[model samples]
Target: MILDIYKDAFEYSAKNLVTLFVLGIFCLFSFLLIPIFLITGYNYRVINTAVHGVINGKDPLPDFDDLISMFIDGLKVVIVQIPYLLVPFVIFVIFGIISGQLTGILSNAIMIIGCLITLAAIIAACLMSQMGICHMAYNDGSFSKAFALSEIKEVIDEIGWSQCIATYLGLIIITLVISFVVTLIIAIIFAIFGVSGAALGADAGGIFGLGLVINSLVSMFIVGPYLSIFNSRSVGLLYTMQI
Candidate 1:
């Protein structure tokens, strides 16, 4: 059954749209596998900022100064753990350009094959990061608790490989389903206005690409909090079933 608090997700997101938008900006810029990392990172910040602001009963608008400080603070914490991430976000742009040049010299298939490897690496990194953070928050594991190799291995091991794969696959399908539904809804409206969705960039094809990005953001706003909160709860329930 869906929880009553699901409504709060939207309220929470709307309250921090500026922060989310800013976070989305940073995330869009930092990419190997889209802006998922930045999206996740931004949520943590938004939640922290929004929750605190509301607790004090105030309006929340994370503008330039607000965002700058947030970025710097986030940078410092990141440098303490993954120091390499802090060394200029500009590297992603440079590396992407260099990778593109290499891809031009290679066949599309070969280029894609190479990209697949990098993409897989990034997805694994992001997912593991998300999982570890979830553990730290939900399980009261220390911020550094996840860094211990054995501790991390246990979390991964607790998720049987087959189940983990299936969960990953399920995430993919859920994302796609949301994307498709949103696209179709947008396209129909655009169509009624005598604007071909393709021209408006809401057509099935255009929207699918756009949908992935939009849906990712939407999912982050709507479903992410639940997933983040209940992930360990679900795992605990499963563990209980086994015992």
Candidate 2:
């Protein structure tokens, strides 16, 4: 079942190169903030399409038409995510502050406890937010549905906790592997061009700097959007188990 979800997600993402490129363009400007909304909004569309079933024998992927609506939808997605992420961040910050006020073994112990709590909070938030986003999409963009904790728990139960945890952990591992491989390839290319030995001369340093810029561009504009689409599509398909 998980394999089918990934296979369908790959096919769905690869169906239109033009759309993927457009998504990459938005991702490139994601630092500008507005573009992120469009990307998130597009992911919401993907989830909505998957949940309702694609119609008319047409591509399930949505277009960039109606920019205003896309932005609005994207804003909703951000709103849903903020609290889930924020709580963990706040917990970490509070713990850091509290830990700093003490000294010696007591301080060390408090910091360790804080770190554990923060880590747990982060993991919980990650698990909940994925399904929360799906809930929002399934309910026709109802913002409140995303935070419907009881419903979210019930949906997770229906989907089976073991399957949900395995899927989430699998995605994390896949992402880490992809990131490591991409970074390694980039490093190898730079090394081949003598950028690795930048201590040799100023010219080597300049070349190394250029390589860094190129690597950043590739990561932001190419790899980032592809992964985003893949993950979003996978989550959307995974949610179908409960439906």
Best by lDDT: 2
In candidate 2, list every pair of residues with a backbone clash.
Answer: none
Which tens-of-lDDT digit does each residue in 66-141 have in candidate 2? 9999999999988888899998899988988998999999989998999899988887788789899898889988
Clashes found in each candidate (C-alpha, N, C closer than 3 A): 0, 0
- On the 0 to 100 scale, the lDDT of residue 48 in model 2 is 78
Residue 67 Cα positional deviation in candidate 2, in Å, after optimal superposition:
1.0
TM-scores for all predictions: 0.42, 0.84
Put down candidate 1 lDDT per residue, 110-139, tens digits, no spaces.
555556655655545544554444444333
Off by over 4 Å in 1: 1-116, 139-141, 195-243
Stretches of candidate 2 above 4 Å error? 54-59, 193-210
Candidate topping TM-score: 2
The deviation in Å at residue 204 for candidate 1 is 20
Model 2 — which ten-residue stretch has the worst lDDT? 51-60
* Model 1 per-residue lDDT at 102: 69
